[model samples]
Structure formats: C-alpha cells, structure tokens
Target chain A: MSETPGIPAPPEEPSEEQASRIGVDSWVAETERHGRGRGPLWQLARLWEYSPDPVKLLAFVALASTVPFWTNEGDLFVFGLFTLLYAALGLGLNVVVGFAGLLDLGYVAFFGIGAYTYAELSSSQYGIHWPAEATIPIAMAAAALVGVVLGFSARRLLGDYLAIVTLFLGQAFVFFTGVANPTVAGKGLTGGANGIPQLDPLTFFGYQLTSTKQLYFFLLIVVTLLATALYFANQSRTGRAWRALREDPLAAEVMSIPVNRLKILAFVFGAAVAGLCGTIYAAIETAAVSTNFSVSVLIIIYAVVILGGFGSIAGVFVGAIVINCTLEFLEPQNDHPEVKRWLFYGTIVLLIALLKPWFRPVLVLAGTIAFGFVVHAIVAATTAASWTSGVPVSGASWLARWAVIPTGSHGNFNNYLYIGLVVAVVCTASLKGWWRMIALVPTLYLTALVWENMLTQNGGITAFILFGAMLIGLMTVRPQGLLGTARVEIV
Target chain B: MTEAEITATEKAAPPAHPLLKLDSVDTYYGQIHILQGLNLEVQSGELVCLLGGNASGKSTTLKTILGIVQPRNGTVQFEGEDVTSRSTSYRIGKGIAIVPENRRLFGPMTVLENLEMGAYLHAGGAKEDFDRVYTLFPLLHERRRQLAGTLSGGEQQMVAMGRALMAKPRLLLMDEPSMGLAPILVERSFEIIKQVHESGVAMLIVEQNANVSLSIADRGYVLSTGRLVLEGPAAELREHEDLRKAYLGR
Candidate 1:
C-alpha cells in the first residue's frame, strides 16, 4: 500500500499546533479524507449544506411548480402530484419516527382516517357535500383525535412494543374498512372493499379544483406550507424538547421536560399532517379506497422517510422525488418497457463503476461480457437447438444472444436460474479481492439471465425488489441518510 | 481551626428547616429493594456528602430525591413540601436538580444545548444563567458549539456541573462526581463543589471517595447494604476508625 505513488505519505511528528490547525487528529486523517470524498458531487453537497434553509425551499418550490407545464395530465398525476403527496406524508411520519424517536408503524391509519372522513363528508355516499375548507380541518381533527387516543393507550410502551401496537392499529384500520364495513346512516360507511368513489374535488368557496393541473398546483401549495411550518416548528422550544427526549427521555424528564405530554403532542401533530395530506389525495384521485391505505402504502411512505434522512425537513422532498419517480418510471401502466430495461442495466453498471481502484470495475465489466459470450457459445454447442433459441423482452436482441433465455416452457428453468442467481450473489458478496472479482463475472451474467427471463414478466414486483436492494445499499453506505448528520452513540 | 474563623462559622446559623429531606424512604427496583427505610437531609447553604461502596444504595438515594426513582413509602420533602408523588419534571421545575451518575450528557447535542435543556423550565430568561455558568467554567463557553460527546471526560464533567447549575436549584443532588476523573481532577472538582456551595446552593454529594468528599463536606453519612451505619459532622467522620479503615486506608 505504501508503494502507491498517488497516495499521500503519512505525517511524521507534526507539532501540536499544526495538528489542531488541520481540525482533526493525525491518526484518523486518512480515513477522514476518504470519508469526506472529492470531485463535483462533494462540492455540490457542501454547497447545499451551507445554503440558507429558506433559499433551498424557494429553489425547490420553483423547480417543482414547473412540472405541470412540461408533462401531460397522466404523467403529472403519477409522477408530479403523487410525489408531493408522499413528501407531505413522509414529513408527518418524520415527526413521529425521526423527531421523537418513536417507531409508529400504524401511522398510515391516520392517513386512511383523513381520506375516509373527507369521503363521508364530501362524497355522494354520505349525501352531505361540505366544502373543502370545512372537511379538511374536520378530517385533520378526527385523525388527531385518534392519534391522541392511541398515544394515551401506548404511553407506557417503548420501542418494539410501541411498533407492535401501532402495527396492529394499522392492520385494524385496513380490516375494518375492507371486511367489517359497518352500516352508518343506512349505508356501508366505508363501502366495503370497493370504498367510496366519485368524491367531489376540493372546492374552496365554490372555486373547484377540477383539472389535474389545478390539483397539482393546489398540492404544491399545501406541501410548501406544511414544509415551511414544520421548518419553523423544528426551530422552536417544542422542537428542542422533542429532540431532548429523543436523545435521552430520562435525562430530558429530569431536566424539566414533560416527556409524555410532548410524546402525545408529536403523535397528534404527525397525525394531523397525514390527515391534511389525505384530504388533498382524495381530491386528486376523486375517491377513497381501503386498498390505498394498506401496509404496502405504509412501506412506501417509510421508504421515503428512511431514504430522505430522519429529522431533516428537506430530506422528505428529496426522498419522495427519488422513490416516486423511480416507481412511476417502472410502472407497467406507463407503457415504457424500454425505459425499465435500460434502468435495470444502467443501475448495475453504475454500481460496478463505484468500486474502488478504478480498474476493478473495468475488469469486472469486460470479464462479464466475455464470460457471457463464452457461456452462450458452449450452451449452444452442447444443448438442443430449442434450448438456446429465445427472444429478449422489449426487443433487446443483443441481450437475447448472450443471456440464457429458454425458448420452450422449460419446466421451471427460470425459477432455477433465479435461485442460482441468488446463490451466486451471496457467494460474490462473501468473497474478497480477485476472487470476488472472478465471482462477479458469473453473478452478473446470472443476474442478466434472471432479469431477461423472469423479472421482466413481473415489472411491478421487479420494481419493488430493486427498491429494497437500493435501500439496503444506501443504508450500508451511509446510515445517516442523504441529509442527516452522523450521530455518535456514546455507549 | 483558627479561633476567629471558627467564631465566624458559628455566628452564621442554619435556617429553621432543611432544604431537602427524605424521611424513612424505601425504594425498589422491580422486586428488589434498593433503599431500605432511609432517612437523609441537606440543610440550606450546607454541603452534605453520602458515602457508600458498591450496592450501598447511594445512587438510588439521589434518584429518589430527584424523583427519577420514587420511594415506595415515606415522603421526600423539597423546600418543606411533600413531593413524593410528583413527576421528575415537576420536581425539576420546583428547584431540585441532579448531576446524574455517569454524567449522562446528551451526546449528539452541543454543550450550549445541553445547558439550555438544564434551564428548560426557565426558558427565555436564561441569559443571566448562561453568564453565571460561563463565569464558573470558562472552558465550557469556548466549547459551547462542540458536541458534548466529543469532549474529554473532565470537560464532560464540567458540562454536567454547569448543566445542573443552570437549573438554579436550591438543593442539588450529585451522584459520583469523581467517579471517572484522575486524582488531580478529582481535587479540582471538589474545589468547584466547595465554590458552588459557597455561592449558597445546598448539595448532597454521593460518592465512594469518602476522604475527598468529607474534606470539603460539612456533614457526612456512611451507608452499607441499604442502611446508614454512621452519621456525623465531616470532621468527626474523618477521624472515625471504621470509616478510615474501609474508605480512607488509614
């Protein structure tokens, strides 16, 4: 390692003043240098770090407001509008999980409550057409009331127990709306699994938000207000109290902070924000469905929060944008099969490029391509003609020639290849140095084979699988998330 | 003692009522009893030390006084009010502060923020409190922006003392102030305790370092196995044979 010419030499016997001037101890300086990173991306991150909060918010809003002009109605609703909604919901969850250090798994129940409340009041199913202004506040209050009840019931529980109880609460919401839809005022309150449809658009004093563009703009305004409000809230006395309790509840309690009350406040505040987002989401979709509030939606919201960085107001928007856009781009309904295919391969290439020493990634990429051609030639020469005759999905003829795609039914050949791919991935990850590099050649080829044969057929599931992998990768690389400060645990 | 100094000390008599008092307190952790029918008190403007070895219920006594651990029976009176059932925050709000064991500083927070949390009850009027704390520990002011976790053990101890003082408590509960410090730092810490005591706030120092605690303390209580075995003036306890044998290594 010392023979490397580019690597800087270790410092020798520097004076105490010189060490202090560098702002780090001499022993860890090399590791610190590596961690700090370099190049344009790090410079950009530093710029972002130093910029004022309001300025960043203004810039984000300016960028987001132009979405309606560039995209059509469908794309705007799927990509632009949904991103804002999730950003709003993720911000609310951030309060409970990030600010107060509570793992509130049942947070989506509040979102469902808000949507259903709006549905009952403003939809034809209830025969009561209340204005948006009244229904939104009512929905928020109803959700906040339930939050208070849950917070009081679970006040004595901590950590895993709280997560369990909240998880049950979330499941209960889904079950009640879908299975045990109670009759209220001569109609099924939640309309069973079908839910309450044909909901009226948000009408503030007779100004209806009928068009998709209008709803998108309306949501943009709501998200901006919520983010700004939360930013200020994070700077206030209550914010400090919440952070104190998050760090050490016992210490905060002995320091004159009312822990239980502040905890309940966090629940109520987070629930109310989710409730507000629900009203707008209902307005945009023009319906309320039980399936919309399932555990899957909860997972997506959690993905947004975790990816964005906990306890950071700005991280929610960044996370929502990345997650929602990626999911939308991979959606089968979007009729963009080609885009998904390119994205899958592009991501693999990007990961390979990030490997250290530069030449490793280059070697692995070249070795995998050569190995794929060699395997294809051998398989074609040995196996039946039908075994090697297969076409690639989305018309990628080049990949079809290289990847082992079966032509006939092949009797679970895809399943076997997928299992083999998983094993190969595990082996590659466990090995090190040149052995790992040698192992990656087969793993990469197997991955391409599995993707071309099986994963492309189920685009939705493939999106989720890739999403999970991305989260694991991000967590391993930077557990602090994109915008959060790295915390030090004293124990 | 000098005749004139002894006369000066005698002329300044203690107030009528003690600032803090625990009357026959019994504290339990789950099923195990930690403090068994313990009685303790700290007079206003006095430095009282509670000396005990491991499992002697010394730390539990501090926790019980600060309301972190409530006694099963008997009352804890602060400023002559029965505060046994009050919450920890309520006790803190009523002017009972504690420098907890291990100096449980908020690791991720800045020194200034930790101090701010100590004065949480007196928010918006903590400018003078900051000045008072900075005056006592000037090093804290310089490192105010730095994270408390990054500070040296001695500096962390200073922050803990400054934090407890920020509450402006009438009676402070300190648990093992010299537990992790070097001998010289321990002496400096005891000196600061004396200085803080001279500023008129009462204190109850719980420690295993009986010799050092008793040197600056006005009164001392020795505990073993959840019971107080000795109680007297600090001068008398220093010369007590059993205390010297067990703690002072005479």
Candidate 2:
C-alpha cells in the first residue's frame, strides 16, 4: 500500500479478495485517472497522489511555479493560495515531526499564538499598534520563545508522552483565551475573548495590498521565498543532523550530531512557520478570534498533513488545499445538513482505507459532483422553505433557517440522508470487505449530527453523540485514518 | 625500603608502561560487576591475541579501546593518551577503530555506505581513502553496493576490515572475525590479518580459538577471571610446556 499520513499502509497490496470487491476495472480506472502526464492539472492531481521523494520535490516546484498564475476567485486559485499557506506550515512541521520524529498534535497552537501575536500587536485596541510587516517579525519572535519553552521540557519526553504534553499546552492556550475573559493578563496586550480586530494589512515598499486577490498573490510570493529558504536549510549540515536523528537518535549521538541542540533547533524552526502563518492569517482575514484558533482548525491542519503524507513537504501543500477547500465547500453555512457533509467525509475516508490506490481519484471526482449537487439542492430547498414557512423572505433565513426547510412543507432531508448513507455503504463495500464497511457507521453518524448541532443549536446532545461515535470509530477499523499510514519503528 | 632497593626490584620486573593499558578497570551492568579490576597491556608493534573462554572479558577489553565500554574505577590509556573519558567518535578520530564482535555493520546500508561510515571520522577526505580501502579488500569493491547484512560471513568480515581501514586507524581491534566461518574462510581471514600486520597497523585480536590466534600473533596474553595469567612472545608462549598442554592440544 502507498504511504498516507495518519493511515497505516495496507499490510499487503490489494489481494484478489480486495480486487473483486472494489472491482479491478474500477481500480484501474481510478489509477489511470490519478496517473496522467504532468502539466498544471497533473500537478494538482499529484498533490493528492502519494509519490516518492523526488516526485514530491517535483510537485513542490510545480506548485511554486503556479503561485504567479493565481489571479481569480476560481476554485484552483483559492486552492493554490491555501496550498502555499499550508506548505509553509508543513515545512515548519517538517522540522519537529519529520526531522525530529516528535509527534506534535498541538502545533496549530503555535500557529495560533503567532496569529494572535500579530492580531494583538497590530490591532487598534492594543493602543500600541504596529504595521503588519513589523508585527510579522514580532509574532515570529514570540512563537520562537514559546518553542523554546516547549523545547526545554520536550527534550525529556518522546512519543506518546511528548504528544500528551504538547496536547496539554494546546488545551492551555484554548482555556486561557476564555478563562482570562479580557485579552491581556493586565498588560492589556490582547483584546481577550473578543480577540483582536481591525488588524493592519501588508504593504510591499509603498504599495499596500487592499484586495483579497492581491493578498493571495502576496502570500504566494512569501511562500515561494520561504520554501526556497527551507529547501536550502534542509540541505545544510543542520538538516543532515535532523535526518540522522530521525533515523536513529543513539546512532546520531554516537556520530556527534548534538542531539539536544538539533531537537531545539527543529522545534524553533517549526514554530517559526506557525508564526509566519499567523501573520499571514492576520492580514488575509483582518480579524483574530479565539474561535479561529479552535481545535477544529488544528484538526484541519493535521488532516491536510495526514492526507498529504507525513515527512513530505509537497504532500502537505497539496493536502492543505484539498482538505481545507473541501471543508469550506461542505460548510457553506450553518444550515448545511451535517449528515450529507459527514457522509462525504466518511465515503472519502472509506475509499482511501479500502481501495486507496484505486479509490483516491474516484472520490475526488465523486466528491466534486456530489458537492455541487448538494449545494444546488440546499440553495433551492432552503429558498423554497423560507417562502412556505410564512416567515417573510429575509436575509437571515438565507443564512440559518434554510436547513429546517420550514414547518409546513414536506422538505425531505431524510431522502438526501438515505442516499448519502447508501452511497457511503456502496463505496465502502466496493473498496474492500463488508467488515470494514461496518466501520463507517459511527463516522457517518458523527459527521451528520455534529454539523447539525453546530448549524442548528449550541452543540446539543447530538454533538456529544457524534463525538462519542467518532471515538469508537477511531478505536477500530481505520485508527490511522482512511488516508494515513501507520508509523513503523524498529527496536 | 630505600630507593636503591625499589630500583633494583623494578629492574628485575617487566617494564611497567604498556602500549595499550587497562589498570583496575571496573565495569558493571547495573549491579553485576562484569569486569573486576581487570589489568592488561599490549606492547608496541606486537600482534597480541587475547585468549579466553566465554564471558572472560576478552571482548570487553577490545570494547574499552573502542570506547564502547566505560571503565568505572580504572584508567584506559593508549600510547599515553588517556581515553577513558573520550567518546567513541573521538576515539575513532584519534585513530582507533574496531571490527566489532558480531560485525555490527549497518544492516540497511550498502557495503560501501558501511565502509563510508567507518570513514565517518574523516568524512570529507573520503575519495582519497576509498582507493586504499578497496586495495586492501578488492572483493569489497565488487560487492560494494550489496546490503551489508545479506553478505556471507567471510565477505562480511572483509567488509568489516575494509570499513576499519577507511578510518586509517593506528590500532585495529578485531573481535572474533573467525567466529562463524568455514575452516578455509577462517584461514583466509588469518592470512588477511598477517597482510594487515605487514602493512604496519598495530593489531589486538581477540579469539577463543587459542591455537589459531597464537600461531599468527607476535605476542599472546592468556586471560582467566579478568586477570592476565600469561604474557610472552608468540613463539615462546606457543612452546611453553603448560601452554602446549592446555591450549595447543599437543
């Protein structure tokens, strides 16, 4: 099986048992869909497909080359923009995760910290507001300081223990944002729970970027410069030490790789990327909310990394675009039904788990068509529901009330839900065994209900149920996730 | 008690200074005192074979020179350079490399990579050393790309030797290179050692096969209970009546 992040590679390649279920023709067709010759489209496809190191490097260059070409609000441009940002994050993560082999689940916290730093420093509420350019360096320095603090203790821990501590640190950041109530700790630094707002935009020499389209292009340039710097850093002696340590710590120490020093450097470098991303987020969104730095965002970042494949730079960029854009498209508004979107996530994951090499392309095409259909259906159904409910056709109904489909009209979301479940089941069965298909039930349920709760109510009982189901689903079947590979260690 | 008396006694005994010396070296694994004040030495230009039964501290002595084993309460000196406090890489840089007991070649790496790592001490000037290593073991150049783990025992020993030579060490410590080879392979290995000796690298080889080790070794040390029981020139030790009776099986 090809290596995917968080997912274990299938112990053996698909056997006759697997081939017959997913069907050899479908597998072949899917493989062909993913394996076309390289151009712009091929580069986008390669972002999703698992490739070797040289292929990954080629993909990075290809993505980097496309930065200048982003000019519109088209899907590809938005995707390319997200890709550059995530690629930056991945490079930072590569230091801690790839080079050091330290599992850091709370990496997003550092990114958030960087973002918040910029938000606080540049926002009007801070009273000592700086330009965005100045904030970028300050945020980076703050992130590095956090990294040093984490590193001081991180050296003593490894694997699961390190993960727990980092996780705790992430939890602490979330709690602190709310617990303190008002942003600053008497320093009046942050705007507190409301978070910093009205942050400064970036300027190149004298030309200030006022448009979203322009900002995207500016981000593209920053990503290119950073990627080049990271590439050279990876080639340097320090990078070699990181690789050596990743390969074997004891052996590296014996070779005089300066184990502790390298570990600290990796953490600092990884944090710096988070800092840079924070700065970018501050300028692009023009707001910094605690909600923006939530656990969900971290999960999305991880999803990108996992989808792209761990220890892969290009994979991260490709993964970021694919994951973030998909999530964005799915959650068009709160009224968007959870069941349908989750069904989408579950089906994609199932395909990856069972028929990985075969189902990857199938899901991509299938998802695009399904998403377009769902969006069209939601728009029509919600618009009709508003008219029938006897409520005046207001703009608020467009945002929230559409999901209910009104009181009197027989708006059948059940039918759509059933269709989604059936599609998920069929896709799961086609890829592998019926036993594995059983594993999708909870994930599907969670995906549905969680979105329902988030859109309709304040994280009601349904959210708890979904969370519980997800926990159970994770315990069995695809513990590594559908698209991720398990890590192998040799003692 | 006078100075004259002490000088006279010292004159009567062997020279105290050793080319490679371990004095009162106490080694332990947790609570187990594996080596109890082990004292030993090797003279310069001498091909000394450490003879011992299993667990008799033969391999451990070689480990001391390679800086793999740290002596808890004693000193390890190589040509008057105190090496007890130095690291393995430092020792390798200081011209001490070992062909370890199990031939611990980097299994995943190729024979060439393993050899290159052996030259890790002098990593930058690798091309210059490569020709020398290949010359010493031409068979290695042929099997250079082959994974070190998959090679046969005899071939592995050659790669191990070539790897050690890549470091250009003055003292080569070999631990049981003939442990699991055919009789012919064992003889060939011994011949290779003789060739290495002629090439002027001081060797301290450890072996359980007393007769074979004693034959090629310029000098021999018989160890029992971590204490040196016998030490003399190889031929003289070979002819010793007690040695011939116990080790040579004559």
Candidate 3:
C-alpha cells in the first residue's frame, strides 16, 4: 500500500540483533553520552545492574553463610544473627513502603503481635508449649488478621494520614502489651511490663533450633527463601500491578487495576513477613518483651529499608549488614573503644577523600592537623595547665596534646564544645568555595575534640546521631537509595 | 460520496442505543460544579468528538464516563448497563478504555510494561493482542523496552493509544490527543485516530482543537461552561457560524 504524504514510512524489518536492541538503543545511547569521566564506583554499579538476578542472590548467600565458620558466638549473634533478622524485617517493609508506596509506620506492631502470639503459645508464662511449625503460622495469621483490620480502617487514608494512623496503632500495641495488660482467663495476658519469658526454642518438624549457629543458619535459609519468593512475586502479575498503582493510582484504576485491593494486599503481605521475623526473633531471644518492639526497633528497620534502596531485595541484605554491624560495634558493652576511635577518624578521612581535584582532601587534612596543634598550643600558653592535662580515650594518647580536653570538672564544657561543633558544621554547609574549605579545618578539629570527650563516653547516642547524619547525607546525595534506579519526573 | 453524505446516511439510520450514554450527569469537584447535568453519547462504531475550550467540562465528561469522578445526578450506561455506581476499574473491565490527558503513562515503567498493564484484566490471548498492537504501530514495537517517560511527546502519545487499544475495548475515550503535539504531529495523530476509528471501535475524543477533531469526527458536541451549547453532525457543526468563529477560527 502507498504511504500517506508527510507520515514517515516504517523502517525495514529488523534483523535479530537489531530487534534485540529495540528498547536498549536509547539507554545505551544515554550511557554512552554520559559514560565519560565516570569513576570506578559508577562502573561497579553498572556491572552490578547488568549481572543476572540468581547469580547475585547466590553470591550473597554464599558470602553470608560463611560467617558462622569464622566468627565466635558473641560476634555471630550480635552481628550475623541480628543482620538476618533485620534483613527479613526490611524485606517486609520494602513491600509496603517500597513496592506499594505506602508509608506504613505502624509495621513494627505486627512484629510485636507475632512475638506475643508465639510467646503465649510456647512460653512458660502461658504454660502452653506448641511446636515452632504450628506457632509460626498461627503467629503470622494473627498478625495478618490485625493487618486486615488496620488496612481496612486506614484504607481511605494516603501518605502522612496513613502513616499517622498506623503510628497510633503501633503505639496502641505497645501500650496494650506493656501498660494496659488486660486479663485473659484470669492471667495478665501480656504480663504487664515484664513480657512473657522462657519461651521454647524453634522446633520444626523434628529438629530444634537451639544454638546461635543453628538459629543463624535457619534464619539464613528462611531469608533466602523469602527473597527468592519475593523476587518471583515482584516479577509476577501482582508485582506489576503494585508498581502500576505506585506510579499513579488514578491511572492504574482507569487501566483496570483494583488499587485499593492491591494496597491492602501489600499491607497484609508486609505484616505476615514481619510476624514471621518476630516469631524467629522471640524464639532466639527466648523472650517476648514490649520493649523489644519499641519505636527504636522500628527506626532501625526503616534505616535498613531506606539504606538498601526501596523495592530492591538484595539492597535489604546490604543495608541490614551495614547498619546492624555498625550499631552492634558501637555498643558500650562491646568494649571496642579503640576500634570506635579509629572508625571515627577513618570515616572523616573517607569523606574528605570524596572531594574533587585530589588536592582539596590533602589541603583539608593538613590544615586540620595544623589548626588542632595551634589551638592546643594557644590554650596551653594562655590557660592553666589542668586544661590540657586530660588524656585521650584510647590508643590515640599521643594526640592528647592536640585536641583540648580539660582535666578538672568544667561545668558543661563538653556540652559547649559539642554545640560549637554542630554550629561549625551548619556554618560550613552554608558557606561556599574557599570560605567553606577554610571553615572545614576548624570543623574537623572540633569533631575530633568532641569525639575524644563527650561522644566517646556516650557511644550509644553517638551511634544514632551518626546514623541520622548518614541518612540525611544519603537523602541529599541519592534519594533513589543505593540500588534503586534514578527516576525522571516528566512534569 | 462526500464526507457530508456519509455522515447524513449514518444519522438517517440511528442505532438501537448508544454504546456509551451519559444522561444529564451532574459532576462536582468539591464545591465547584464541573459537569452540570451533561448528556453525551457515542453510537456503535461511531467517531464522536466532544469539543470545547478550557474549563468547558470536556475532560470532566470523559472522567464521568470512566467513573473516575462520580456524578451527583443522572446515570452512565455502557452497552445499556448502568455503570454510574461502579468503580473506575469495573468500568474499565466492562470494555471501556481511556487515553487520559497528558498521556499519563507510568513514567518509570517500560513501554511494553505499560501496554501489559492495559491488558491487566485480560488473562489469555496476550500474545495475539500484543501482535495486533505491534502491527498497528511498528515504532512502538521498536521502542517497546524503553521507559515510557523517556520517549518523545509524539512517541508517548503513540504508547498511550497503543496501551488503550491493548485492552480491546469496544469504546475508546481519548482526552486531548492533540494538546501537546506539534502541528505536523497533530495532523499525523488525527490520521491514526481515523485509522483506529475505521477498525470498528467507537470513540469519544475530547479535544480543545475543533478543526482537527471535526475533520474526522462523524458528529461533534460543543460544550461551554459545563453545558452543551451545540450538537449535530460534524459537517454541519464545522459550518455553524458560532462554532466556526469560536473554535474553527473562521
């Protein structure tokens, strides 16, 4: 047939190679245009994206499974086991916040429900000893039932409203389990403040998961299975529908997707996963305490999901590993003060290294060292000797002469120094060009001074503060998260 | 025969009922009454255009038909079944599809994935359905794997039209196909619309550009401030002095 005037004729039929390149041409062209001057990090990211899915999963599983072989029980439990638990929790929340685009802040309540349900069934408080095979499903179902109720109640709400309602529900669960402690069958059902204790170990079929190593392996297997299952689900019809709704609910509805139903399904699915994690966690700890499922735990889980990159399964594992390990290492009881000191300095150095033109990092480091020495020398010359007498926290004893730490009791001196450091950081951020570089020298010195005095003493609070700083940094630098694809909004 | 004579014969032999009918539908956006007791229809296999300038309730009429915005009064019937109380998804499932304004293609999704979403309600025969769309727009087949957002404006319009056709809808509702296109592409888009209309699917094209829409539309309705000002055969509407002055630029 003759083609109409002005309408371009269709191109010749594509060869197999050309056909395969159909949708990829533009992306390849885009990459080529922007490919120059990219660092190794970008190349590494590109490589990671190009690799097959199953290969990535297998590599992660293989690397993670070997932790039990090298590490002792204490390190394994704190680092290895907790990482797996949080990974599971992160995966669940990813479905809600990541997949369905629902900011479900009350997610941790489902975890609590699962823990309490398992505790009631198997703990000594209730005196009902059910096997793990039976109680796990029951706990999951219990959480799912509550999920349906919550989902229905908050069905009409979106974004912050949904978040607020879910937050209230979470707080209600904590109060019901911790403070309210309603009586069921003449016994305080929740045990009021002192949660149910002495829970039986997870016994599946015939084998019991007792030791930390055994439990770790069990969780590894479960998480692997969950990831695999979720991977397939994400590729299925439901996954597409979830993404469709996430992109535009109105458009998805007009295109024949039941958006409300999918939203509720996402909630219930996330709740079920959290419940399963809670059961395993309760089994491992041998207790179900209201304090265990607090807002802090919810924050940690959110940290993992955000760090991992929303809607990414493998990102959950990476996020959990990085966060759990860092938090555990910073614990005061961990007694790794020297390690913490080195970590603090190492991170600052890494941040400086990210500066462009190479010479900037060197200039900043040299300037900071000179600035610290000058400040220390001026204080020693002007003030009393006691002001410079205090020693460093750990192995950096030689550096005591540089950073100022007063010997005797100085009222709110450390507080003043911390406030100075924060003000310096804010000032440095707002400044531009050479002025900013000049500001960083004093800021870096003040950071060291604060770490040596106040922050080292309160490792727990410092860890959270650092975590918050990291999240803010990530948000500014890469709002798509570590592994997520960058999106372009066509306004 | 002339285009006017063809439209005259079509009007002479009216169908038993319209494939889609909105009878005195009253729609509101909160306190703002947008579509005030609007009545519209598209007969089987007919190409009808709803024409009006901005804020003329043209878009609102399309939304009311798709059940995206519920009407306070009157009814929306699809194939003689009242679907006013149904959800948007239900209306879509009952063989109604829309190429929404601004071509709200899921930007993050691939062109193929967006098309797959259009066929969400249909379970089987996707291979054949995909082939049908691919044959209609070969350029879509070429750029099928690219993200919908990355495509050019005219290309995005093609994806939107292809997406709607994937559902195999008996009636297609298009909202402003020529809004963002260049003059040349707008002409090309109308040609495609004419081709699609000839394939036996009824269409209700909501457009602000009256000259282009009326050229191919069998019948047209002129709406002004939430009210239908004029309605007749497209040839007569194009010749009407008021419409020619207001929309057709004489």
Number of the top-ranking candidate, with DockQ as the measure: 3
What is the Å distance of residue A206 in model 2 from its true position?
3.8
Q: Which is the better candidate, 1 or 3, if ranked by DockQ?
A: 3
Q: Would you list the clashing residue pairs of candidate 3?
A: none
Q: What lDDT score belongs to each candidate, Candidate 1 first?
A: 0.85, 0.65, 0.86
DockQ of each model vs. true complex: 0.50, 0.10, 0.58
iRMS values in order, in angstroms?
A: 2.8, 9.2, 1.8
Name the regions of candidate 2 deviating beyond 4 angstroms: A1-80, A145-161, A164-186, A233-238, A287-303, A332-491, B1-19, B42-70, B98-125, B136-166, B172-250
- Please list the residue runs of candidate 1 whose C-alpha ends up more than 4 Å from where it truly belongs after superposition: A1-31, A351-360, A385-388, A395-397, A419-446, B1-15, B182-184
What docking class should model 1 receive? medium
* Residue pairs with backbone overlap in model 1: none
Q: Put down candidate 2 lDDT per residue, A1-491, tens digits, no spaces.
A: 12223222323333423432221234444666554453443354345454444545544555455554543455434555566677677667766886567888778888888888887776676565676667788889998889988988888687899899988888788767645645245654555676677877765455688775676667766766665677677665566556556655655544434577778788888888898898888777787766777777676676666566555555566666656555444434423344444555566565444444455446544554445346536665667644334331222343233222334434555345434544554444345454443434432442332344232333334333333333333334444443444442221
Candidates' TM-scores? Answer: 0.90, 0.65, 0.91
lDDT of 1 by residue, A1-491 (tens): 11322212322333533443222324345555455645554455556765678868877887787778788888898999899999999999999998998999999999999999999999899789999999999999999999999999998789999999999999999999988999988899999999999999999999999988998889899899988988998888788788889998888878887889999999999999989988888888789998999999999999898888999989999999989988887665676667777887897897887676678889999999999889998999999887789888776688777877778788988768866876676666667778988998998898888778876676677667656666775676668887786785553
A471: Cα error in model 1, Å: 2.4
- For candidate 1, write residues B1-250 as lDDT tens digits: 5446546654776456578888999999999988988998887888999999999999889888888788999999987889999888788888888888888898888788889888888882278999998998999998887778777788888899999999999888899999888999999989988888888889999999998999999989999989989987899899999999999998
* Candidate 3 ranges beyond 4 A from true positions: A1-46, A354-360, A423-443, B1-16, B29-33
Better of 1 and 3 by TM-score: 3
Candidate 2 chain A has its poorest 10 consecutive residues by lDDT at A1-10
| Model 3: lDDT of residue A43 | 52
